[model samples]
Target: MAVYRIGEILRMKREALGISREKLCEMSGEICSPQTLYRIECGKVKVKRETYQQLMSCMGQLPERSYASIIVPKNQYLSIKSDIYDHLVFGEFEKAEEKLLLLEQMMDRSYPRNRQYLMKYKATLAYKLNKIDAEEYQRILVEALRCTIPQWDEIDMAEWPYNEQEMEIIFDILHTYHALNLDEKYLDACLKLKMNIERHYMDDDYYVTWKNTVHAIISWIISNRHQYEQSIEYCENGIEQLKKYRIVGNVNRLVYDIFWCTRQKYIESNLPEKEQAPCNRQLAQAYYLSVAQNLQSQSEFIRKKVKQFDIKELFFL
Candidate 1:
């Protein structure tokens, strides 16, 4: 079966050399059609050794002296890595991590700095594990960032292929750092990267998604510092942008976070009844599970002190 597949690779190589199926049939004096060529390429049909040689001769190109010249019976190293990456994108973090560990063992450490794809994968795995020993994770991030920047710069912006999957992996790292709240510099770097992505890849959907994410993170940071007005401004700008671009997936999450922040602001300001009520209702509904778990504490402390509003009436409204 494997030998048959090897013959198929040879057929594809011939076709790629610009040798038409009809031309190959004429040169080799063998009956062949485009459908026959496809079947061979797909490994559903086998060819005799002499037929394979004749086919190669017709194309005036032959496999060279390289590992890829001879097809391996089993999957190649990169193929397995590709499969693992697919699993990672689909949220199979555990299975992806297991395969990544195996891949690390097989890696040639002498070429440690080579293979940008592998480095990116390692960075992504570290992010998934939430391995937050800063020095370690940042080391991986730095390498991945270095690789990504150069690639991003060289491509023609007009025709560049946006790797959404890779972008998502990097976003995971950024979101992780945001969660830890320990690496402001790294987070800033992430925001700069997000801006670069938006500037150059506006046509790509990821641009909007990442932009909203960064906006949401920035709003959170500002809100934590008690910069309520600035926080609301950032969140409102982000929400407006998301709406403008019709990016709905993360908009709701951002809205929920923004509402919570707004509620906090109202409580801090001791805002008037009419103004605080809406924000309170929004926070309560968005964070119902948290509020439920701490209902007594919330009523005694948060609800009581946030005296401008009535939770019961707000919920009814």
Candidate 2:
């Protein structure tokens, strides 16, 4: 069993309600000492079956097994999340929508941590599908932010895999706010993203994936603003990071972003009309050729993404 997950679920639920450890013990009729409760919540000691039942019953939950047993297996949860992201990357919106529904159906609301992840993913998927308007997107994000337990210890977050998903959410917010021309909110999101990156203090040195993901988010966020030079730099940096810890899907995404940024920069350039037109055409042609070459060596799933782009109309310039 994932002791950390079990403890995090318990702690997040209790903290979300502003219930103190002493109050939790009192509510459970002091069935376990406060020190013991602390140990369980810290994942230093596993709660006994009876103790688990007693504590949960006090919290108004009645499960057939221990809280840990009711969780979706970590591997299965990760697989579902990864599959949804892959579908999105490949422009398989229909498949992404289907998998997201399966994920929602599989989610356990009793676990607030899972709910946090679900809300973020659902909001992103909804935006991608055009199922939510800008107002609805902001509303959903506000609600999602309000529910995250503020007191969660850094230790727990560092232990969790895919920590960069938080940065991705900020990127989504930055993009949305930019579209709405909400400069204040966009700047706030950018600052939050910076803080998030700086505060990540993992015990282990093997965090290449986290670093790559952060760079990718930075690249994508700036790309939305047509800040091509900075965006391209971040994209190149991210590509190098991915090279160090190569994942085909991630590499494909960074390259795609880089291509789009390059095309955007070309279109937005202030060169002489003659130079601008030729430059834009050259960039678009190169982008198409690069994508075609990359997809040609991949599976049909990836090749299908090529159909989504039309180089001729991609840059109005």
Candidate 3:
């Protein structure tokens, strides 16, 4: 049984409400001090059942149920939240907004800070609906950014895999809203944050993989923006760095493919005539061959691993 301490539950609820510790203390009319709340959330102290119920009741306005009944696997909650966020990023504003409301109700005030994310979703939804209230939307985004800033610091970027798919989804959202400048700023911030994470927390393997992934994506984005030279430079840098670390795996191979594809594309785009440049063609062919060989090796490796698995061990019979 995965039992959470009482304090942990309270803290999660407070965060879900998007209320800061100080704000929670104020809202609860000093029933709990910020320090006390922090202690409780951190599982340093036990909260009285009565006090817990009181706090829950105070913040349970959205969900007409007790927070205790809403417990489930943490990953399940994350998946649901990710799905809603995906919809928001994909321009399904109305549907996302509806889902956000439902999520809020389901959350029952757990992890109140997540309310910031919900607010961001609603603001973006409003923008999609042609509600030209830029001021309000920007305010919500700023609030969400404020909450996210600290989390960026906490994340272990090097070993922690980049959510490339989610990044693309967010990029699309910003593009749809004509917020390219904001998108660029966010990407730059993420890159810097990842660098910090690598510097402070990552092991060698993690650090190498993280750096390569960031560079590859950054290069891809710059290439799309017509900064071909800068893009190629980033890709080449990533490939060199990954090779130095000997990070041989699916991710490394993918990075290699991206580097070669982007390099070839950039060269092709710059050519003056229909005829292929000999140097460019040769380089492209080299990269293509490397990519094919890497993929073949990976497929063979996976087949061997699968062959080693004992299916009978999974069955009672």
Candidate 4:
């Protein structure tokens, strides 16, 4: 059903412009009928992609663009794009490719932005298939990044066409960069990912998970660079945030990350080898705690071991 608010907005805009129904139809090149416009204004029928495009143009709302031929209808495009996204995420390359071909056919080749998004998906597929070398993949990423989210500060993802799906895809590319150990790219990607997550905070499970994942990745990167203290801090903050949000996803991994960072710093501390055993014991206890919390059957036994070894005191220490 047509939303009444949309009808009201259309009526108000049309009246404010002092454009009669006949003049509006004339202005719209008569692509939509006057009766259809009346139905839209009365909320009798739902507004369609073409009708909305034309009506908005008549009201000087939609800017003129050369991508006019790329009309696959909004709903169909969204459905197909969603299917493609699902297939790509789940490693269903052949299915994703099939749908991608249809999506590409629906796009305007004249539009550079269209090709940039396609290149991102293509680069992602190529990377997954091991067809492109890491350098080539990174180059493709650089190229795609040029066009995606240009002027990130000036633009709002929510206001973008397609609800910023392209921007989300760019985040996937950043994740791949992190996975590849492309340290040079981490600073930019992490900063942007942080900003993106902050701006689009949905207060939902997925957002929480992704935010924690990014923090964990950043922690891992920082630790590899021998910044153990910062790594521990990031891990601690992430674990606490997850707990505060009541997110039960395996936070043990992050706690173990802290343990690993602590172990690294201990190795660098130059303490007597005998004295290091206490720290090693604490590290082992941390690992055991992670395993116990992760597995129900092991939790009871690990709890007993923790008490036997006085590991609970290690927590306070």
Candidate 5:
């Protein structure tokens, strides 16, 4: 007998009947995930009263009509949050989407951050898959940001600092603006987010990852405004941070951004041969780095830019 509490009874009954957690979840119409059910059975999380009742009924156990005082553990919650992020970063979109569904069932609704992450991931996947247009993506992200930043639209991003989750939402916002070529918004956002990063620097693994991501993004943001020197500085900073943290996810893109800015600087300014040499070399290095990273899309993008701009100097140099 799993004699811990009322929650444990669900486990005991389910086991005695030989119904696995997945089976129970399916039988219960997936009102909760297998992990959620396991946590509930272990008294590790508090589900809604209705959810508890439905799950109990699925186990052929009559409800006691009493409240279940279960609460999900901190570590368990963090673990799931990290897992979802890992899935997203690793390009496992389907897995990430599925986990988001499970998390929606399992996570406590009272925590605003839970909803925030859920909304952000949902928006990200939808936009990535072309299921939603730019407006919809921005709308969902703004709502997600509103979960934590009530005055998100009116607030000055640099005026206040944000935590990890808020920064994550902002990162998505940055991506959206850049993709849509909303230069005014992108530049404004870049400055604000940069200030926030400086204000709240944590020694967390998650924080480090976001920091590197921001660095890569803001580099291009700076470059777009014809600030190539500053942009390359930001890119170099991103690369150094990646080395310090041993994170390889964005190193190639960071290098690409560096070349992007440098090549633009040389072409627009028509730098002397001495200066153009570095720019041409950087362009070649960027193309090779994209190939080395096995990112066909990025490599192709560089090739297109090279031909489009008649930057044949890269091939010769």
Candidate 6:
């Protein structure tokens, strides 16, 4: 019964970690009053979507959307959506489709926001199966997002209260555009994300992940112009911010980017190998972290780069 029963699970996790409601609320940047959290944990009230996610993130939970929000206010809908998401995540497309059909059968189709949410999952599944190209996937998501904010394309995002659901849709659109190598659109999305995060996601782990991504994208765009040192500066800034937030997953990737940029910068300057050893060592440390985390793909990619660069003496370095 993959139903989240989010309230119960949240309460259990909180207590298991010996966290009180007041302290958890404080960790969430006071997004909800302690009273509200108590009511939610007691199952006396349905929680807002973003509020619960914020608390969960603060509590060190996975920061991905795994269940439906309270917007639909139906347990059956939430359960089915959770199942669909899990199936999709685990590469069980056929089972995911079955669950999606079950969800479609029960979901109310009149509310536009709810409608867009459904379309979002559908487009994602289609894109995952290669039924649609990145541009088409982006087009579908943008249209869905416009259902809520008709001026999404033109409006300054800072003018509105940030909505996680909408932001997730925009991220989906950005992911597709990034894959398509639509640099202008990708840069615009990253900038909008940076503005939104700065304004709303105060002191949460999600903020660290999102901010790091924005920094990395900005660095990439600068690197494309051959501003390698400038790119390294952005990556280093991102690394420091990630450390300050006490997050780990994305830090090594930033280190890798820094190593990449420094290599390019040195090569472009005709620098001696002695000048390059530090970045090479930085590259080795990032590789070690990837392996420690069991991130096989990233570790393998880094290992291939070590070979390509003939990075000898990494074992001793």
Model 4 C-alpha lDDT per residue in residues 95-164, reported as the tens digit of each score: 9888888898888756556777688778877878888876688677667655533443343333323123
Best by lDDT: 6
Residue-level error in angstroms, candidate 6, position 191: 2.2
In model 5, the worst 10-residue window by lDDT is 62-71
Which residues of candidate 2, in runs, are more than 4 Å off?
Answer: 1-70, 73-83, 90-106, 150-165, 183-188, 203-207, 210-232, 246-317
Q: Which tens-of-lDDT digit does each residue in 76-133 have in candidate 6?
A: 5767767887787678888887878777777777866678878898898888888999
Please give the lDDT score at residue 213 for candidate 5: 76
Q: Which pairs of residues collide in candidate 2?
A: none
For all the candidates, what are their Cα RMSDs to the real structure? Answer: 13.4, 8.7, 13.3, 11.4, 15.1, 11.0
Clashes of each: 0, 0, 14, 0, 5, 0
lDDT of each: 0.57, 0.60, 0.53, 0.65, 0.71, 0.75
* Residue pairs with backbone atoms closer than 3 Å in model 4 (clashes): none
Model 5: lDDT to the true structure: 0.71
Residues 77-180 of candidate 1 have per-residue lDDT tens digits of: 65766778678756788888788777666665443233445676776666667754545665665565444334433333223222443354466556656556
Q: What is the number of residue pairs that collide in model 3? A: 14
Output the lDDT of residue 9, model 6.
Answer: 59
Could you give candidate 5's per-residue lDDT for residues 1-317 as a string of tens digits? 01124564566556645679999899889999999888887778987788878876775544544322223454565466567777776678888788777767776877666677778888998887789988789889989888755656654666444555666677777778867878788877877777655543344555556667778777766777789999899889878877887776777788878877877777788876577666656667777766766767677777887787567744722
Greater-TM-score candidate between 1 and 3:
1
Lowest lDDT sum, 10 consecutive residues, model 2, at: 154-163
Candidate 2: tens digits of C-alpha lDDT, residues 1-317: 11124565566556645678899899988988888889998989988888887876676544224223224655676577778888877778789888878877877876755666678778777877898887678667655643442333322322222233343554565678867977666655554555544444332222445455556766776778778889888767866765665544456556666766765666677544344344344345444444645653342333343354333443421
Error of 1 at 310 (Å): 10
Top of the candidates by TM-score: 6
The residue-level lDDT of candidate 5 at 59 comes to 57
Q: Given candidate 4, what's the lDDT at residue 121?
A: 79
Model 3 reaches what TM-score against the true structure? 0.41
Which ranges in model 1 have alpha carbons more than 4 Å from their true place? 1-93, 99-117, 124-132, 148-187, 198-200, 272-275, 284-317
Q: Is candidate 3 or candidate 4 better by lDDT?
A: 4
